[model samples]
Target: MVTIKDIAARLEVSASTVGRALADDPRISAAMKQKVQEVANDMGYVVNRAARMMRGVSSNLVGLVVPDIRNSFYSTIAHALSKCLESADLQLTLSETDDDRLVELRHIRELTSVNVAGIIIVPTARPHPESVRLLKMTSCIQLLRRHASLGEHWFGIDDTQALFQATRHLVELGHQRIAYIGGTTDLPTGAARLQGFHGAVAGSKAAAHVREELGAPASTDFGRDAIRRLLALRSPPTAVVLGSVQNTQGALEELHASGVSVPETLSVVGFGDELGFRWWGPGLTTISLPVSELATACGLWFIHQLKQKSANPAPYSSVSPPTLVVRGSTRAVEAANASRAPARSRQLAG
Candidate 1:
């Protein structure tokens, strides 16, 4: 509970002199500033953030809204964000929306109400018009996701390039029959990744046997269901590219239950470097999203936007390319198995 007054009394200086020193005001002499700082440190004094905000000096608070706290990708980013923001002497307020638009909107309103210096959001579901409107009036940055109409201040890996690279990896491995699992076309990440998959497959020999299993964002149940559907196909894929870590776990469970050996009968590549892979007997080959990098970039962007509130914001933004991590779950396709044609690939094209 040490205050500026306490430090001033001990130094026999005016409280305003101590305040100016604390603010790093150039008017305060360097010798006096150092003396005030030493006294403040000795007295265990800390600037009250709430009081500073009230005085319009600094809010010292940032809000972060994530879709799911349990998701490894989001959690990793949150950890990095907290660490980075803390180093800058700022506090973070975190909220989870569980992919519910209403909940996300409410969280945004609450954060804005508290007058946080800025907000970093990973939106639940697609971008809504109302959310865009709210963002226009607030200092906010979108992280690992984007809203179609929201101008700039977004940071996320190039999902499309990641998927395309994954598909091409399978192609290079002699996997002509490849299936994609998780995420529906309506979601931006899903659509972008799908486009990347298609782009890589186009005009390729394996393009004839590519199949997609689109649904809700990856979950254990969804993973099982998508696998079941893929297995039911007359010519099941020899290799699969999974969209999320959750789906990767579910797929592994289903594969194990069916006694299907990974990278033996089927090769699996997943997105996100889930923690489960560390312990799983067969480590999953995954294209790990740069969560920490994205988070740090978003944090820096949020700070920049807060400082440039009056400047015109950029229109639509994204992060740099993602890095792909290859692990043990996937292997070269057997020539005999790879030679078989996929019926669905032909049907879809027809």
Candidate 2:
């Protein structure tokens, strides 16, 4: 347990000078700061974080609160965020809420109590009022999901456009009847995605037949159950658009178990470009979201806010666009086979 005094004695300087240099206090000369820092590093003079915390200073740790990490979507973001923070010599503290409001509240409360530098959260559909209040008191940024109770300090992708492009692609392939599987409208992502799917179907020039199975807590089980319901329909859709990542996984699982041949029986469009998606049957055509880019950008912005000592006067929001990737899991219907070129031609093989 090397202390400031040990570093000061080794450097032939007073403890106060060593402390100021370690804290990067402007009063210390750059050369002296450099010398002190080098010596402190070599001596392993760890900072007294507890003492600083007792003095009301934040720890060099940022907090991240998200839903299940099993979802590639959230896990990807977490990895990106962790890597981004590492460059700043900061550590990330991750917590999961399981989409439960009480669980969400508890995590936020614990994070705030610790005086973390900042917190990044994928807000639940309905956050507890106190959770909202605690976040407002800190430098907080929302990712992917948003609640009205929380301000506009967020980073996310265009959910509506993501779904619209997916749903419309099938329509252009001469598939009139389409089925949509997604989460409920309680969350912004769900609402926007559902809206996009509906928009693409209704706005199409051709008459479109649509069936949707949407409900709460978008999980793999829910996605699988929704596909089962759609498959039971008297006139099953020719194409299916999975609106959430968890739902996409579940839908694919059910589709496989039912012995339904993809593209041949039912063309499928998945939510995220998970690694396994390419290896799935005939390669799954899907929406490609820049999760890493979004997460990194959000982290950098939060770091900027921390430097400014407050959020930008006007709430800031950044929305990234999603790309629709084409693959063999989708093909032109017989009617559209010779009618026109496919909606997209950029093909990726597993």
Candidate 3:
């Protein structure tokens, strides 16, 4: 409830002088601004955000909309974005869409209604046209997993190249049967990753390989179910690649439950470098997305756009390529062992 008048009276200055000093107006001398700010801080003065909004000024709050905040991938992005926005003197207003189209549209509209400085969204898999319409109501920067219709200001990782390299790595280990689990073909990232998996398998020097399954939604349940089904297959895959962090975690759990030893029984690769992956029983060999760099780039870009201070033209797109980190979870398959194990129906246990 502290007001500028209270600070002004305490500092023996006029309210207008206090306001200008609080805003750091050039007309206010440095010594005066310092004194006003110190007194205002000590008095716990708070800005009249509603009054500023009424005068056509927005709060220094940016909206970050993501599918699931509990997912480590999105959580890491949020952390990085928070740090970047903090340095720029802006606060993050986070919203979760849960990958639901209606929720996504609602979040965007709500943020716009509040006049958020800008919104950064990792949109749902199949965003409706209404969602796009709602997004146009505010300045928005699309994050990972952008829909084709709303990629005007997008920043994401190269999902296709990442998966392609991962699949190729498994192929190079002399395994002919590989399975990809995670992501529906609805979103661009999902479709691109699936294409990358197929592309690698098709181009590999392996004579013939079987693709067990391509799961959907990139959730823990989907990952767990997909791995179970693939393992139950008669000629099961020798390697499995997960498309998301949640999927990787779920798949790892399934593997452990089924007593499948990574690299020995079935090689495993995952998307996104979760902290647990590095220290798990067998370190995961996986594709690592540049979460921090992507968040920083998106935060800076959105901040620039919100302030209209950048000289660059609009319709910006930034892509961070993924990197594959090799670890203990993958190993070269011996040709003799692969041939001998095709019919040994112990259910892919290492």
Q: After superposition, how far is residue 208 of candidate 1 from its true place, in Å?
A: 3.7
Candidate 1 vs candidate 2: which has greater lDDT?
2
TM-score of every prediction relative to native: 0.84, 0.91, 0.90
Badly placed stretches (over 4 Å) of model 1 are 1-3, 41-46, 127-130, 275-279, 301-318, 335-350
Show the lowest summed lDDT stretch of 10 residues, model 3: 341-350
Model 1: per-residue Cα lDDT over 4-55, one tens digit each: 9999999999999999999889999999999999989988998887787666
TM-score of 2: 0.91
Model 3 lDDT, full chain set: 0.81
Q: Residue-wise lDDT of candidate 3 within 1-350, one digit each (tens)?
A: 99998998898889999999977789999999999988988888888877877787767888999988999878888999999999878999889988888988888877877677778889887787977876676677888877668747889888889989998998888878888886778778888888888888885654366564556567888888889898888987888888888888889888877767666678899888888888765788999888988999888877777667554437888889899999988888784356444423334322
Clashes of each: 1, 0, 0
Candidate with the greatest TM-score versus the true structure: 2
Superposed Cα deviation of residue 230, candidate 3 (Å):
1.0
Q: List the residue pairs that clash in candidate 2.
A: none
Q: In candidate 2, which residue ranges exceed 4 Å CA deviation? A: 203-208, 335-350
Candidate 2 lDDT tens digits, 77-161: 8899999988887789999998998999999988888789988999888898999899888888889988767888889999999
